[model samples]
Target: MSTTTTDIALAPGTWAIDPTHTEVGFVTRHLMVSKVRGSFREVSGTVEVAEDITKSVVDVTAQIASVDTGNADRDTHLKSGDFFDAEQFPTMTFRSTAFDGETLTGDLTIKDVTKSVTFDVDFGGVGQDPWGNTKAGFEATATVNRKDWGLTWNAAVEGGGVLVSDKISLTIDVQLAKQA
Candidate 1:
């Protein structure tokens, strides 16, 4: 609805993520030629907006077992020890440490390893749904090295390069409803 930061400030309150309207996805190079995209089907999170938006906080968790890549076999492999090792890790989490208008810095944990990462965030504005719920939307993106999280399993291609690239791109589209 074109609500800019100057026009509509994020209401100061705790906002609960609407899982049905939010997406946590990623993209990575496959076989050094193409890209493979996937998403976690189950995610939960909350955003605490302060009177001063810079004081806000964000926390999120994505179930590793709920990974979907349009291919059941590939999903299974992603959840295995080669990747997330869902049996042991179960979930990946992110806790924001800072938010400065354009950038959001957070500690991301995967497979028990926590590292600080920054995401470029675009505030998509605030609005009210037909149901009368106050909602806020945001789109964020970041890139990280998969190997940094200890997800190093990869196969060499017959001709050249590797089956999987080390860089992974993360994209998040979130919609939060202000909690009562």
Candidate 2:
């Protein structure tokens, strides 16, 4: 389709991701003792690689209510005002502002709050499937203090750290399909 691009332009032509093959997930510490992880059940976005990504463009969006942590009670609390406030925020998003090699700076919006966040990205290279379809893969992740995102719900731990550590890690394993 002419809507997609063949040459690697500073802006990649429109590409619709296969959400079934792509994953949007995050990891956070539990009482500074172990880690807890989860993934959003819904996600969609486009990738516009104009010229090698550092100078390329990327825009991504994910539904806030789609958050799943394998626990029904916890997910509800996360949707409340104390955490994500999905009613007010609705969607959390990211749009790239700049990229320097594997390091990317972008605007991340969550719980009606927007901020610039830097994440380390790894280019896993593009390849062709057995069906001859072209695909590109990359991994991007970051660790942030939940307090900075205003998700400060926690309990005091008499032994040492709080009921939940302030630090939260976000990781995204992405697979993008190229122009057919």
Candidate 3:
């Protein structure tokens, strides 16, 4: 069954993303074989929960320089011109256009290129933190062509396939606290 905003008891108001608990991660195939995962450590966003849950809106921004994949070299390269070109475009943003409890459709902009993408939304429910703060959790995922956002750098592998796959899978785990 589809969930409604009321069904979750998420109060109507502006919910600010808790950066410390939120993660914006991506996974892509390497050499068309192994998968490489990376995530942005700095992300800020807000969710405007409307009385009608379907009308809720989400807006987020991630700092390109905060990308971390465990390897320092690879992380540096990702910030270079060959990839995200962090200097030219220091941030990526997402603005929601529609939300239906199960899916969220939005405009994602990277490197000045904007594309509409849809993510399957999984609500992780709401609860109170030790500080008596009201918080909600959610996980959303989507796959998109990296080239669409101008992230097309790649090299050919020794045996065959390219170094990086065109398709990039995005997974976002977010925790939001309702603002008083």
TM-score of every model versus the real structure: 0.96, 0.86, 0.96
lDDT of 1 by residue, 1-180 (tens): 322335437889999999999999999999999999999999999999898888899999999999999999999999999999999999999999998878899999999999999998888888999999999889889999999999999999999999999999999999999999
lDDT scores in order: 0.92, 0.76, 0.94
The all-Cα superposition gives candidate 1 an RMSD in Å to the true structure of 2.0
Q: Clashes in candidate 2: how many?
A: 6
Candidate ranking (TM-score, best to worst)? 3, 1, 2
Top model number, lDDT: 3
Compared with the true structure, what per-residue lDDT tens digits does model 3 show for residues 1-180? Answer: 455554566788999999999999999998897999999999999999988888889999999999999999999999999999999999999999998878899999999999999998888889999999999999999999999998889999898899999999999999999999
On TM-score, the leading prediction is 3
What is the TM-score of candidate 2?
0.86
Cα error, residue 151 of model 2, in Å, equals 0.9
Flag the better candidate by lDDT, 2 or 3. 3
